[model samples]
Target: MQPETIKTQQPDLTGAAPAARLHQVAAFAGLSADQTAHLAQPSNIERSIADHMIENMVTTLAIPVGVATGLLVDGQEVMVPLAIEETSIVSFVTDSARKCRPAGGITTSMSGTVMIAQIQLVHVPDPYRTRTLILERRDEIGALCDACDPTLLRMGGGFRDIEVRIIDTAAGPMVVLHLLIDTRDAMGANTVNTMAEAVAPRLKEWTGAQPLLRILSNLADRRLARAHATWRPADIGGEAVRDAIVLAYRFADADPYRATTNNKGIMNGISAVVLATGNDTRAVEAGAHAYAARSGRYRSLSQWEVDAEGNLCGSIELPMAVGLVGGATRTHPTARVLLAITGAKTAEGLARIIAAVGLVQNFGALHALTTDGIQKGHMARHASNVAIDAGAVGEDVAQVAQEMIARRSINVETAKAILAERQSQRAD
Candidate 1:
């Protein structure tokens, strides 16, 4: 399929064009006038809802929501709405991807998503003895587990393998059964958890190993997605800059403390999309960090190297267990809209896009660290926000923001002062 194109997302201010013309485009399709207005300005309000057999429950929380503009994935133009609060996140990723767009953006590939369901079996007289029984009846047990979610089987996904581990822990010797499940497109949590519960009773009877916990493990090492991108040396010129990036990457690669911050840069973008979709961002984050240290040493989630051709090549590999069928994927209207814009039908496809976002975002940070420094480009974008917060009106917003950034004081107070000075000059 051809890639999408990026277009200016500014609302139609002029009353000249036919309204239907805008609706025909994919960008404006499937949205009501009211929803369109809501997108133009999002709100975070406290609301109450009744749960089954439960009375009035009120929740107070701030939704860190915003929009990610200028997204061009595979020639498709999408204006993504992100609900995230972490500073410098959305800006860094979007800016990096824009610079790499000329090189055909970033291309991503993913492995077939296979999430592991850990069914803990404990209090057994002999875990080693139980291991033999489970393995011997692997297919039979796997079928019993798969039968719980027939819909998944009909969709060509279900329990694929069964393995048992005899772990000697501080508490005692225990057997941990692993159900390697193929979740297909959806996040495999509910499916695997259900399967685990179904097999628990059978497992207890067969091996006499009591089932303790039947839950899905967030350490999604099996379901992995990766993305890669390359930037020409000419695009990011000078030997000094190249060396600086390589050095910075090495610092991150070698030290866990540095690597954590560097990886956080990548997650800033990935988590935004994940949050927008109503997926579990915390699970994704946990899986990523755990996967990074899977080899016994904590390191950078991304790898950076200067290729023989002198072009900068970057890649990232992370555990991404995202889904499409369950949770807020269908519940929230905005998530539904964002999913449609990406043209992703399956959960794995979304994982690939998330991987690509991380790659582009990390590149953004490394590029900044190597060249003019991380604050320059980020502060420039933030200046406008400060200006607005300082109550700069209309055209003066941009003008005053530019002056604040130029003076190296891109803060709300500086912006306010600049706006007042500009107004006084105009009055004089």
Candidate 2:
């Protein structure tokens, strides 16, 4: 599962046939011929390995894996795999990544791989006294949490600290206990949940209060990853475009409605990478949205600014609770290969790369939004899908799409008209 140990020379999938690309990546990763074929066939019987990974004995659900090229992160060229069903995301991020590559690519910073477990204590009589008692018993609570998993200890990660918070609500005053654990290369849901359960009885014992909701917090504020990129104004169509992008950011910054969509644009890139790398998208999304409103107002996750030299600068900081170990990240054929292709050395590196992708994606979106428009390039890119939808197969797909474009109308109705005429001419 350590992609850093991939000693074989990497494969360049440029111009490879789509149908054959899966096996090509498998071979590049030094898998056996059987594993290579397994990558292509979801019904290979090998993928649905019964009862171990999941339930109901169903087959694997597959999504088209598209690569966003030209990303130079941390001085290393990376091909990011996106598992999203949306159009223009891969193209947009790729566009920005290429534009900023000459200016030293992207620099990133990540906080610790710590996850939080919450022990909710209800019906506390003396809240202040209970808080003091809980703080004094920090070692006992931390020791009980650390004992929940032996393997987590072997990985050089274990319980770190405990925090107590007293909240007053309509129901009454309640004391909350927070357990911080370094789960190390794991998404840490199960690990932190186990610790919370293990320490729950003691938590109830010490405070003479009811312990409920022993679980990990999805608002992973502690495990944050950040990325920044700078692009010269001339390189990105001069000062007007730069200021326009900043204005585009201002619109989002000022309005919650615009900010949600703006942040969704960034998550379009982050979520795809998360899905591709086999992380929990729902948890990541929850944390991201919660982190967005941490300042009491929802706003964009990224900021656009002009540097002293008039170069456009963009930065993004968000919760990235991704991991390299366990779950589908290690077992899923495509996910494992994507990690290798990404060439990230650690979980932090993986997180940094994802954050950088988000920043670049936002840049492309704003750049397009402030200039021509989003749909001009996006619709043109996806017109072939519309052509296919209109029942234009094979040779006629491109033909119908081209005609639709020529007519300046790229939709189902337009595509169908082009196909019908083309078919009539063929019959004639």
Which candidate ranks first by TM-score, i.e. highest?
2
Once fitted onto the true fold, the runs of candidate 1 whose alpha carbons sit more than 4 angstroms away are 1-81, 86-88, 102-104, 388-400, 419-428
Note each model's CA RMSD in angstroms: 4.6, 4.2
The sequence of per-residue lDDT tens digits that candidate 2 reaches over residues 313-384 is: 999999888999978788666677677767776888899999999999999999999898998988887899
Give the runs in model 2 whose Cα sits over 4 Å from its true position: 1-16, 19-36, 42-47, 50-60
lDDT of 1 by residue, 97-149 (tens): 66665555677778778888888887888878789999999989878877888
Clashes found in each candidate (C-alpha, N, C closer than 3 A): 10, 0
Worst 10 residues of 1 by lDDT: 44-53
- Alpha-carbon TM-score of each model against the true structure: 0.84, 0.92
Clashing pairs in 2: none
